[model samples]
Target chain A: MSEKIKILYVDDEPDNLVGFKASLRLDYQVLTAINTQQALSCLNNHQDIKVVFCDQRMPNVTGVEFFEEIRISHPLPVRILITAYTDVESIINAINKGNIFRYVKKPWLESEIIAAIDEANKFYIANSMLFIKNEELQRAYNELNKFAYSVSHDIRAPLSGILGAINFAREIDDVEEMKEMMYLMEKSLKKLDTYIISMHDYYSLQRGELKIADVDFNKLMDELKAIYTVLSKTNNVEFNVTINQNEVFRSDEVPIRLIFNNLLSNAFKYLDKTRDNRSVDVTVEVQKGIATLHVKDTGVGILGSHIGEIFNLFYRANSQEAGSGFGLYNVKSALLKLNGQIEVNSVMHQGTTFKVTIPSI
Target chain B: MKLAFIVIDDSELDCFVSRKIIEHVDKSLNVKTYQNAELAIEIIKDNPIDNSEGLTIILLDLHMPIMNGFQFVEEFEKLPIQKQKKYMIVVLSSTRNANDISRILSYNGVESMLEKPLTLEKLTSLVHRVQQGLN
Candidate 1:
């Protein structure tokens, strides 16, 4: 059995105190206090005491008065008033002041007391858990705020560098030189777009307002493939999509779009420049109630060690590759919000594949 | 006589970009770039630009390592009215926070707040606005 829950009982009569202890001592760690002063003293001594049962009639001070005193010093310990028919007015007052969790008459059932203590213990545990969780959430918010400031400062320098080069290129009258500069400017602008998109995703997710809707998986995949078709053609890479299940996928399409967009864009961006066979294959299948999609690419694969932290914010696998390092982080965050899962497989020189699973709702 | 302008920003690239854009907009405009607020303040106080001959426009960056835009403004307010009137201050900042924008607008001599990197369209519009105000 688990540790017994502690209970403190205060009564003026020796017989009543003995009877109560004898009845509850086996099930509870019953502590007896003969007077109001002794009850307060007992509470101070045993900090873990969960419930306090006090009799209405006592010398010099009543049970309600003692409860009021305990309320100031040890507010958390649940209070239970033991009263007869005569002290109903005082019992009502105790309840109104929030001093008592419940009341028990003088001729009380052992079962009733046990039930009340059990409920009180549950309340105490739940309240404490909530308090701890709130503290953790507050700490995370503070860390995120600091992270945003540092990231903005770091990114601004590189952006200014790119902007300066663009301006310098504009001053030169040579057409060939201007074309080369425009190419470089386009590359930098892509990086800037990636950074801004990631920042937007991070802030929006932190705000926690993801709009969920019914989405057509087949149509969405077709649209994505069409969007990247021109880029794929320019790079001499063939893209294919295969869907085994043609069911309507009900989830937040926004996050799903973000995840798929980043993954597909990465596949296109990091294609094997020297390889003759440049291709990407996207396949989806449903088993039972779960839908899984696989995106496999013949591209520059990730290292084994770097795979673990690929989803971490600002973590780049290859610094040489033009990337903001926020794409995968956005993908992971979006998947988490959608209650989906992703797994990556890669062989350094061969290729990389990402498998994503979502529950069909 | 050419209009004299001072660009205060920690980023060398941003300073260069702003200077080029301003010069492009008005060919006769004489532009000076400073890497810190303190250096810019020193030049403004020690040897004041001639107000009647040429208008001076101060393009102040909000986020700088040594001294920020708000602190620069506080210090600039202490200068004589003639020296202040010789120049119109335009805040160049990347901060989109409402509180920061509101605070910048609250300052006495600030002409307007502009977001960076300063595009040609924004720079030209700002110049026209300032030129109209001066006349």
Candidate 2:
């Protein structure tokens, strides 16, 4: 009781207050308040006052009125009212309307007072626990809603196109026409496949635990370059990577890879095809336990109005391009998990730049 | 002279389907395909659509590179009123989302909204409407 739980008792009579503290002092670290103002001061000074006891009859205000007033300022402390025969009605009213946790008659025995304190303490714990759990549950429900909304809209839209094509293809028997329909079916299936992959990446980032490791910037840059080289050659894309690292940086590599993956894919997807000098440049520097990665692309840039919402799931600034719209959103969450940050600078029709900074733990 | 029909969509397959459906409905309708909305807007803004010729209709896809369907519609709406009267606009989409439908339908120039694959049944009615004109 001295280490944790503290109890406060308010009474007008000095002898009764002293007697009450003397009885329960060993069981509870008890404090006596001669009036409502003194009880409020005790509550303000001591955060551990879990249960409060007040005499029903006082000079200025009744116990019910005191409980009702303190209910606003010190709502966490469970209030218990003490009354005599004449104030039984007042005690009942306090229990009903003043948020009183329990009540005991005046000249009560030690066992009865102890029982009231124990019950009020239980009520206090349960009340606080319920408040904390409700907040957590509300957050979980919001995340589930985002996942459900993305799943329905992104997956169903592609499925409808595939179904419509299959239904239309069955009626046509011409070889050339059938060949064309087969191509359409193939495109729809590929789109579905890409969407499923991004969905997997999304849920994995959301549910999977992070495992930190020392990342090799040189190897990572080489891998990225090798994978995109074929595209660079075929599409006339000018791709470059420059890395400067002097220190060992530690962080989860999956999210870093995903961040690069999404940014690189966007670089290729949104490139201005007509421009002769289309390029995507990646620059990385690691120093003082901080790694900075920048991806710059000479692509069809995003408009200023759409820059804010680009990371939102299923949001498309240029909806014509086939994108799962999960890439940037996945990148955002993954960066958050790694305690990293990302920024975007874009000017419509000119180009776009993405900057990311990550700290090693 | 054959009446011109402009089909603006990012997907080549969708353009092919739309053109095929138009051919089945009325071979006389001259169909043109643009992969980007900017080019289509340029053609409209340049007034090369030839109003004195027969009826002109635009089958616009809601999603496209450079400029999206709504942005293109906003630009097209800025064109001279006489040119707007010469052409009928209809939006084609794979989305059955009520917001997209209601929003697109709210535009005065848009004649109707059609779902994907551009079925012959939908094309027949569109062809009929083109032949009937605004009269």
Candidate 3:
């Protein structure tokens, strides 16, 4: 223990308290008390005290009584009772009641006291670790329950729509109507395909270890432009990219790619059809050890009330267009993995802008 | 007086299919579609059909942004007793969640819960059941 483990000792006799602190002060941070009242105050002041030792025969209150009182107040610190050979029966009762961890003899041997302190510290560490693990497991279980519902809803909704379209097409003889049905079917299939791809991104980002390397924003932006150019042309929305970087930025490329891909897709997907001039702009700046990126789009912006909940899993703000609702959630998760932050600014029918910052690994 | 049908679902494709199948089953029927639950509720609150005209069959979707199907039913029940009698609500959803199914069924305004992709047979049977007072 580089830093001493704190231990508290309480006894009625002033000589006993001094002797205990003198013997163990070098190895442990010993806080001694002359009475149960002093011991309670010490516990309140130093919440991190790992082991509490009390003399069984004390003025006003006994060791067992103090242990029982503190059992509810300061439950974490392991309690030990110091008693004589004559008080064996009471010590055994205290141990059975789970009030104390163990007992030290009246004339304590230094070795026995050291052994008790070591064991108590180990128990404290193990208990805290178990508490943390249980919390993590509970969070994972809750997420899995949500995943189950989202999977069935997201996948089934589109599939059932496609099936219904097919059924309707079978009865109609009009060529133009048949083509319309085919278009609807294609749209549903595309939504399903997008959902499946993002689901893949979700799993990989969750399980995969971060592979950090130098992130060249220029190359990344070029690749994104190559993929989204055709889509931008078809929708008649201008796509612009600019990068200003003089420093070497390092991070996990996969998550950075996932984050930008989702953001850009959303930028293109929600443009206002009534607007004649629509544009999506991207700008990246790296300075010192941080990279700041912005994706601004001229689209039908999100409602003000929906700003806070957009990142929630399976939450959709706009029902007019078919969306998997996993895009922003995936982006948030990936940013969390990389210790990054994202912020959004938008106004209805005006536009939206997303800003992100990442620190070099 | 002829019966009328109203479909309130967020999905445009689902609404299209439902309207087509509903019209094909009986060309004489009148169908209205709403992509938002709030707009549908507003229409009902503003101009509830008269009981002497005909019964209105409302096919409501369970999942929608802002106001969901459950909230819509609650709002519908808040209307006057005579106005409520002019329409019958049937829940339409793609969700197989047991709790959602049971909870929506518990609403007094909801007649029955039907799965997604409304077919000609389902519509025909529903109309027959309503006509004979067997629902």
**Top candidate, metric DockQ:** 3
lDDT of 3 by residue, A85-152 (tens): 87678778989999999998889999999999999999989987897898999998999899988898
DockQ metric for all predictions: 0.07, 0.26, 0.64
Query: How many clashing residue pairs, candidate 3?
Result: 0
Provide the DockQ value for model 3. 0.64
In model 3, what is chain B's TM-score?
A: 0.94
Q: Write candidate 2's Cα lDDT for A176-283 as tens digits.
A: 997976787688678778889998998899899999899989988788888888888888989999999988989888888989989998998888977889899999
Higher-ranked by DockQ: 2 or 3? 3
What is the docking quality class of candidate 3?
medium
Question: Cα RMSDs of all predictions?
Answer: 11.4, 6.2, 2.7
Q: What is candidate 3's CA lDDT for residue A250? A: 95
The reply for model 3, stretches above 4 Å from the true place, is: A10-19, A31-47, A58-62, A65-75, A93-99, B48-51
Q: How much of the real interface does each model capture, measured as fnat? A: 0.11, 0.25, 0.55
Look at candidate 3 and tell me the lDDT of residue A22.
Answer: 92
**Which prediction has the highest lDDT against the true structure?**
3
**Which CAPRI tier for candidate 1?**
incorrect
The candidate 2 chain A region of ten consecutive residues with least summed lDDT is: A153-162
lDDT of 1 at A271: 84
